[model samples]
Every structure is written in C-alpha cells, then in structure tokens.
Target: MTEAATRRVPGAPCWVSLIVHGLSATQDFYSQLFGWEFRPGPEQLGPYVRALLHGKEVAGIGQLPPDRHLPIAWTTYFATKDADVTAEAIRSCGGTVAVGPIVAGSAGRMALASDPGGAVFGVWQAAEHLGTALAGTPGTPVWNELVTRETASVAKFYQAVFGFETEAVVSADFDYQTLHLRGRPVAALHGVGHGLPRDRGPHWMTYFQVADTDEAAARVTGLGGRVLHAPRDTPSGRLATVADPEGAVFTVVRPPED
Candidate 1:
C-alpha cells in the first residue's frame, strides 16, 4: 500500500463517504468485509468515523441527520482547489449545490452537488486532512464512476465544472467516457440509458479494492448485506455489486493482475 500524504490533483476523486441510518451496524458490516478499523473524526458532521487500513485513512461513514430524507448511498468527492468556486461553476453549468461550501472543522471545506443527470457528488477543498490517505491495497477505494442515464450533456457539465478532459470509448454498444486529469484517467462516466435503476437515480459508484471478488461477495451476504450482482469477470477485473444491510450500494473489484 502507498501513503497518500498530499492532496490529490484537482478534479480527481479524493474521497468517498456514506451516510446511513445505522452507524454502528454499518461500521460493523464494513469492518468485517474490509478489515477496516475505525477512528473518530470531523465531529462537526454529527456522528462520524473514518475508516483506516493499517493506520492510513481509507473512507468515512457517518450517521444521517434524522429528519433528512436522504438516500443511503456512497458519495464520491472530487478534489478541488476552492470549494466556493467549484460550487459556483456547478450552478452555472446547470447543476445544483444542495449543501454548503462549509468548513468541516479543520478537515476541509466541502459541498454536495448534483450533475445535470441528477448524479450526486462532492467537491472538497483539503486543509489538514488530505482525503483518502492510502491506496494500492485491498480494502481501500480504487475507483469512482458516475453511472447515469446519458453521458453527453452531463459529461460536458463535469468538463466545464472541473476542467476535465474526456476520452470516450469508441465502441457502438458501450456508452462510456473516461474523465482524465493531467492526461491520466481519474474517473469514468457510464451512460446506462434505459438500464439506469428506476429506484436509484443517477449516482456516483465507488469501487473498493479486494483480493478476491467472489469471496467478497459471499462475505457481503454472510454479513447481512445483499449481493446485487454476482462476481463476474470484466475487462478491468472481477467485480461484484453489493449493498450493505441498510442498502448503501458499492462495488468490490479484484483488478486484473499486472
């Protein structure tokens, strides 16, 4: 595993978080699934804890505000130099900023926003905390992708808001575009068309690295979660889609061997 001590490049996915109704149960589910240890942090946001792998920060889980009727799903946060500017850019580009560009104590400044397709995400300006602090290891976040109804207009929205360069897959059957930062692929936008789940609107999907995809899927069920998709081999790796006990969906992937 590698230590991520510095802020990620602007527009790159810097962190992923989930807000759920059952904080203790959610933590227990992830701890058994990913071998993550918890540490209290960023207390400004109600009851929250950061997941750590071998002392390096990996992700965060927090309890949802009781009165807010929000979905229990993971949110992907993109690194930005200035949260206020990014929030404005989102508004000007036909997106909405649902939350503030408020400071999370000394951790960072953040805002929640949704794309033109209604895919929610976050813009983070790092301060003392540099988002996810480890990578290249099992149990840490490896990839983030926006799965939406269509890619063309929403892709343009992201490009305008974050200055990302996009490279689209040329295949006729695959409607996908990879978002690039400094010529390196940072994230992806997948146009699922009619395949988009009716109950779950367009959303950012976070992929956590695992050693074995099949075993991980089995473990998810054993831990009171449900496997939405069985393990399957993809061009990228073997992966499975799963939802926690409270139905926060995410993917677990075992990357193709190098």
Candidate 2:
C-alpha cells in the first residue's frame, strides 16, 4: 500500500482553518459565537489573522484578495507529508487542484483541492506547526463531515483520491459510513438525500465546538450571519447549520466529549 494510504493522523480530528472573503465580518461572527480571541500575525505575513479559543490557538483566518469573488466558508485541511504528491493524487482521482502546494515558511507546506463531489479540502505538510495546537473545546474544531445526496459516488471520489476505505454504517436510527485510513476512522460520509434544500451542494462542512446551541444560533443572526437550519439533536450532539455573511455553510456542534 502507498505511504499516504498507510499514513494516519496519530490523533485524528485536527485543527481546521479557512480563508474568507470578508475578514472583519467573519471574525466578528465567529468571535461572538465561540468567544474567540484574535490578533495580527507577523507583520511580514500580510493580513493573516490567528484566532484563539479559550486561550488556545484554534484556526487561521485571512482575507481573500479584492479580485477574488470567493465565498466565506471553512476549509478542511488534513495533515500530509507531501502536499505536492497529494495534489497529484487529487488529479489522479478525478478531483481538481484549486490552489498550490505553497510553502508556509518553517510551518510546513499546504495546498487546496476539491474532491470529485465538489468538496474543497486542504493538505498540510506540518513542520514546526502540527496544526490546531488545541482542539475539541470551546472554540476549536469538533467534527468534520462530508454531506452528499449521492454518498456512494462521493465515497468513491474520496476513496480514489485519499486512498482511504469506507463502509456503509447503517443502524435502526442513523445511516452513515465512516472513512478509514488504514482501518482507523478519519472522518464520516453520509447521504443527504433528496430532502435537502435545492441550493445545497456536495461539500465538506467543519464544525466548531460551542457551549450552547440556541445562544450560538442566535448570535449568528445577531452578527449578520444566517441560520441555515435550526438547532437539531443527533446521536452525537446538538448541531445547527449556519452561513457566514458571504454564504459558506458550516455547522456548530456541542457534543459531550469522552
């Protein structure tokens, strides 16, 4: 098996960061929900801003150049050893490379690409920075999911690119499959079915841990963000779908940790 196939995150569910169109507004929306703290990064780093939750570094947020019309949303990044090879794997698997195997100084390298199902994800080659030094508390990434109406096609798409295996996980109440890399659970994939809204697209949504679901949902609307779905309970936790001011849909989950 390929090294990439065998490679597993020693601790899965790593930190997730995103590049948004409107940095100021996105910052305000998230800070209120998670009580995030932010400050300017190195002066040479341009406009990149680092965010901390509960006094621990959680994610990075930066503004897209003025010429780009990208929507504001969270992008998921997986830890990889070689970002360039991963980009090639993305192409080889019927996925597209959307960005670069760009270097992040002594912090390792990264690249952005989309899966065959149109879900965008990132690959991080960690050096000094291993990603989300802190996670799963108030203000860090709690869970990541890929939601699609055609789960089989999406599964094949990810399996072809990431070299991970997936099995159908069906139960009396829930229908989902867990994605495994070398038999280790990396993430989950499930069908959204035709009951989903029309504007919804096959995509990966990152969830942030929070204290209260209703308060978080209300704060999203209070800050110019939209609540795509109201608070709902799953076997895992209480979750609510939301969109940043620029229209990227993500979820906020407050699950009891083990």
Residue lDDT tens for model 2, 170-257: 6754557888876777788867777555665666788877788878888888888889899999888899998877787778888855
- Give the root-mean-square deviation of each candidate in angstroms: 0.8, 4.8
**Top candidate by TM-score:** 1
What is the clash count for each candidate, in the order shown? 0, 0
Q: In model 2, where do residues sit more than 4 Å from their true spots?
A: 1-13, 41-46, 171-175, 182-184, 195-197
lDDT of 1 by residue, 1-258 (tens): 787648789898999999999899999999999999999988898999999999999999999888877889999999999999999999999999999999999999999999888889998999998899999889999999999988988899999999899999998889999999899998999999999999998999999999999999999999999999899999989999999999989999999999
Residue 80 of model 1, lDDT score: 95
Best by lDDT: 1
Candidate 2: Cα lDDT at 30:
76
TM-score of each: 0.98, 0.86
C-alpha lDDT (0 to 100) for residue 31 of candidate 2: 81
